[model samples]
Target: MESDSETHSGEDTTPDDWMDLAVDSPDGSPAASPAATQKPSEEEDFKLSLITWNVDGLDLEKRPERSRGLVKYLNLHNPDVVFLQELVPPYVQFLKEQLVNYLMIEGGRNGCFTGMLLKKSRVKLVESEMVAFPTTKMRRNLLVAQVIVNGQKLCLMTSHFESCKENTAERLKQLHVVKRRLKHAPDDVTIVFGGDTNLRDAEVTKVGLPATVCDVWERLGKQEHCRYTWDTSANNNKTFPFVARCRFDRIYLRPAIKRGIPRLAPDHMALVGLEKLDCGRYTSDHWGIYCTFSAE
Candidate 1:
């Protein structure tokens, strides 16, 4: 692991400045970054599983079908915490019913609230708050929960970053809010941040964070791999939809190491059209990224 001090050795000394990091693909291979000469030991212990997904519209009535599917999926994996994006209050109420024993906390503005539904018997929500940014038009909020999972304290953050286009400096400033929040979190707590970042390949350069926190997907090292969170069938490799395959939804973990966990989604849900353009049929434009870690 590269230290924050080491990563900052090069130029780009601006506060929000970030180096162009070459990340890995989904297949546990190196992509934009140089391949590692040696791999880590497989016997390393201490694991936890995390799932990040955008439940599309989260329509209270029609989308409960998707909610039902999601509940069942969680029951199977039973992650310590689930980071969800785009869940409206009504849908949260519906999910509350479906997930009878779980405690729910929501943050952010209307359309982009981030939520965490924790199994009541398994975890306890100790503290939480919203990340307010002065420069942002719509305050991008983060729901942070201090949870006790199997006798362990895990800090889970549900975040939805800014999306509307603007100058690189502004975007970087917004991203700094995310970084500063994570950096300021209690050092003793085991922290994990996940959600829809709305970042394209080019925008990845703007994110700045301590080395203790890493983009899980970037650790894999195979950047060119067929890894895209959104479907861009209509756009011709342009601004909005950068490439044929684009992954805007992201999950960033602190204290948890990268171990490839299978991507599990609602059983019946499928993308009928482009991932982003909801055509009134498909559940969501983005697919879920599921990763597992050992609790022991």
Candidate 2:
């Protein structure tokens, strides 16, 4: 993985600057909103929408404007749950101010870390905790949130695994930790994990997801349009002489196995942040993955 100095040379503030602001609520309670009062009928099928993105908070150029663009996209999509990686303190503050209808949970307070946003109206947070990687050189860790959506339990997990092609071993170890969590989760709770995994296809094949789990992109027929999340050729936010494309950002789903709970199926998948902002830069160096699941 690239060191902090190498990847985030533009960063001006120290980690201590945002330590106090990073405290999460005791119960992860979200403020009441108008939408919270409206409940769906029991007979109606429930749909869950999610978005996962690496917001590239390290880059300080056009930072404020870029954050506005992110808010615009989030408002436009209005996902029920969101998994965000590469989050810095300032970016988290900006999101809290703009996204008033979401409950924000930080994975770590210092440096760049991961976070989860649960919509105030649709999702109810039960608890949240972070699992640290024992040998992570980049301070990477897993952020897990237990949430309730329409009375059904869901385990939401997000992480920014060790990056760089050279750190494949470390990335694999991190992947194992995630898989173990999924395998041990209660059978009645569905598991949904998404983030910038920084994994290669071969590595996933080697570790292999649980039998109940399925890669959202692969389960949806691997549509070419949204296949590559980290495509330098398409996103020009970072200047590079050579073009590169990789599916670094991904989502995995493991539906509840116990009977009674409705199974969530992957229904739609698409990429966001494709358009350039007014400042002539994309939302981030990597595209965001948007997906919808229908309870069956």
Candidate 3:
């Protein structure tokens, strides 16, 4: 975890917002042939660099030029997939222009949208859908997509849960709904579902479905690794410095079968997009985070 994560700014703005490749021989080669197609290495089998960010749509409205920096950051970091919340038209349009190689699947309307940006050059999109939680007034939505990479099917679901501590029940219900949905995904695919949960340790711990989903941050033994995503102390966002700072953004993995559990390489995990512009302003109110996942 970065010490700069000491205090994330902007509370409950919930609605507001990989690995090296090993080339395998294409020929139907055998391991012994030394020239035939070889089995995909674990890194090649499940390699993924995933990011989740809540871009504080409201903040972007004030400083829209930041979009350029956002685009530049994405290009520089270049994660394979990005989960975004509180997306606005300009930002979406900017991404379309800048991230021309990505397949952007957006959900919801202008005010509060959620979506995923999959790198078309890296993964093949097989299917997709969007989901809405029934019990919340916040009108959050989840974006789902299935992509094939290196012949492995991965179910990717990103969501923005109910916002504010007041909607704790709704968030919990949403988690249960997500857990139940993931619990039934076809066994042939690896499941990963997460986004702006608007949740803290208190409620998240209760969202127990160990056999299904596990917080990858915890798997790395860095529970507070995500603390600065929405910290008040880190930036000059509207929130007062004393306001509580916690990470509302997250990414989790659900092992479809015991055989497909993951091994998270620590080097690829960290909070990103926190760099200050030459003008000393942040790229966004939220700091993006990403991790590399490979089958164990």
Clashes of each: 16, 0, 10
**Residue 292 in model 2: shift from native, Å?**
0.5
Output the lDDT of residue 221, model 1.
Answer: 49
Candidate 2's clash total is 0
For candidate 1, write residues 92-158 as lDDT tens digits. 5555544555566766325546677765645677776665545655456566677766555677876
For model 2, residues 20-131, the per-residue Cα lDDT tens digits are 3332335654223334345645543288999999999999877676777777778778788999998887788767755778888888776898888898878999888788
The best-first sequence of candidates by TM-score reads 2, 3, 1
Which portions of model 1 show Cα errors greater than 4 Å? 1-46, 58-62, 108-112, 167-170, 223-226, 233-244, 256-281
Quote the positional error of residue 117 for candidate 1 in Å: 1.0
What is candidate 3's lDDT per residue for 93-207, written digit by digit as tens? 5565446567777775456677678876567888776665766687775677888776677888888888887889888998887787778887767777768888888887787
Candidate 2: give the clashing pairs. none
Candidate that would win on lDDT: 2
Q: Which consecutive 10 residues in model 1 have the weakest lDDT in total? A: 1-10
Off by over 4 Å in 3: 1-46, 60-62, 223-225, 258-267
| Root-mean-square deviation per candidate | 15.6, 6.9, 11.4
